[model samples]
Target: MGVTGIGGLFFRADDPEALKAWYAQYLGVAPDGWTPWEQQAGPTIFEPFARSSDYFPAERQHMINFRVTGLDAMLERFRTAGIEVVTKAEWDSPEIGRFARIHDPEGNPIELWEPA
Candidate 1:
């Protein structure tokens, strides 16, 4: 059979332990060597942007999109936790979804999407 789904996402971090802990504490993502986070089943987008695509930042090589529920609550939580979240009215639609952006301590772009 072909690839089933994303098996893992591995990347380098300036302070790996701190980064791992940050993900675990804020996003509920399991840290390295712990039980892999069990993401709820849903749609996954796998589009390759053009070199000059301005959808996300140009400095970063990749942007990860994580589907979520309760978009408003999550945004509020992030704000209360001192994590800046960016949202645009134009990015949401009845057909697509709502989106918000945040960066990790290392400045990696993360997109949180809530399906419409």
Candidate 2:
């Protein structure tokens, strides 16, 4: 049988409740007792990068890339919610698509990618 796509993304949170509420309020992702995100059907990129790859430039070591539909809308939402969203023109690629960066409460890099 062929392998399926990613089932879930689990990570550690200092305060799970607060983190969940933050995500729910901003990104529409509600962590209901560690439930997996109910994402829309679209391309789910699954690839491994070199350990020293500088593709995602961040002070932190690990970065989580999330697929989104409406980048502008999401960016605006984050801005209105008093969240900082960083976008770089150089990060945009004709092949990889548009990308924006944000940080979680614990300062984890989160890449918001809208595939072409």
Candidate 3:
């Protein structure tokens, strides 16, 4: 019984309330004072990126990857909500999954993955 799953993800937000609301609206994540959200049981990836990796913005220290289902539907929703979603054909793999990228209002990179 060493380290378990992540307890939470805490980050500095210039406008915490606005960011929370954005997440709630676009990603369906509950905001402050709301019930804690639980993810369905699944594989969670925990890998470190190289300091010079071009996979994401170099200025940011970390990028958050979230497991998702119905990625096409979600992307459509994000587009309808005016959220810019970035995707590349090369990023998808039959062995792994499909991927899409988007930045939060705070400019943090968030990766959405739909396992194959």
Candidate 4:
């Protein structure tokens, strides 16, 4: 059979355990290899941005995007938890979705998409 979906993401972190815990507590991801996170049926975008693109930080080579349901409420919770969330009006559209940006402790960029 052909590829079904994304299996897992492997990346380097300063403190793997701490990063894993951060994702687990903040983003509610199961970083443990034994427990796989379930995702709904939806579209998965796999476009590559230009090298000089300013969509995210230039120092970082890659960024991860996560699809969300309630953008406003989730952002509010993130704010209450003292996590910084960046949103721009231009990043939202009636056809596409709302978006917010956040960086990990190591300055890796992450984009949150609440699709329309």
Candidate 5:
């Protein structure tokens, strides 16, 4: 027996409260306080990025990808909320899925994925 699944993700934020609020407001994460969010299971990718990879910003140590249902709807929501959503044609395919990128208020890279 090995690891079951990801327990949680911990990171440092300049203003934890404000960051938490941003995540709650936009991503629908931690909407009901510090309780656990029940996620609908599917595919999860756990790949490490090369140091020289340009997939994400150079300054950030890591980028997180979250599975989503509706890519277009989410993109529209992000646009309506005044958040910049970055998408590229090369990042998507019929076999894998679609992806969009957005940064948190504190400049953390967040990737949204919608599986094909």
Candidate 6:
């Protein structure tokens, strides 16, 4: 057989429950421990950022990028839910579409990208 799409993204969380709730509430991501969210069907982009990349400016070491649809609507949802969404002018490119940043309860940086 051939390789399939991404199955899951796992990471350490100081409070898994709270973190899961944050994702589910603000990002509309389902909470399934160790199980991948069956993301809405669409195009996906996967790439690694260089260590020197300033895309995510947290003191931590890693960031996760979530490919998403309806970027504007989602950003509004996060704001209505009292979550702060960060945007940068440089992060937007004519070829790459728009991007917004948010953090989980445990301070994990999440990049939400809407593809071009």
| Collision count for each candidate, in order | 0, 0, 0, 0, 0, 0
Q: Which pairs of residues clash in candidate 5, taking residues 3 or more apart in a chain or in different chains?
A: none
Q: Of the candidates numbered 1 and 2, which has the greater TM-score value?
A: 1
TM-score of each: 0.93, 0.79, 0.92, 0.92, 0.94, 0.79
lDDT tens digits by residue: candidate 5, 11-47: 9999999998999888888777569988887877788
Please list the residue runs of candidate 3 whose C-alpha ends up more than 4 Å from where it truly belongs after superposition: 32-34
Q: Candidate 3 on 1-116: residue-level lDDT in tens?
A: 78778767778889988999988887877655357778788888888989999999999998988898999999999898788999999999999999999999999999999999
The residue pairs that clash in candidate 4, if any, are none
Residue-level lDDT of model 1, residues 1-116, one tens digit each, is 89899988888899998999998877878755466778788899899999799988998889989898899998999999999999999999999889999999999999999998
Over the stretch 6-45, how does candidate 6's per-residue lDDT look in tens digits? Answer: 7766678888898888787677687665666676776766
Better candidate number, 3 or 5, judged by TM-score:
5
Residue 79 accuracy (lDDT) in model 3: 91
lDDT of each: 0.89, 0.80, 0.89, 0.88, 0.89, 0.80
- RMSD of candidate 3 to the truth, in angstroms, is 1.4
- On a 0 to 1 TM-score scale, where does candidate 3 land against the true structure? 0.92
Q: Report the Cα lDDT for residue 58, model 1.
A: 95
TM-score of 4: 0.92
What stretches of model 5 exceed 4 Å from their correct place? none
Worst 10 residues of 1 by lDDT: 28-37
| Candidate 3 weakest ten by summed lDDT | 28-37
- Preferred candidate (TM-score higher): 5 or 6: 5
- TM-score result, candidate 2: 0.79
User: What lDDT tens digits, residue by residue, belong to model 2 across residues 1-116?
Assistant: 87677776677889978887877776677457566667777787667777677766545556778888899999998888778999989889999899999888978788899997
Root-mean-square deviation of Cα positions for candidate 5 versus the true structure, in angstroms:
1.1
RMSD of each predicted structure:
1.2, 2.4, 1.4, 1.3, 1.1, 2.3
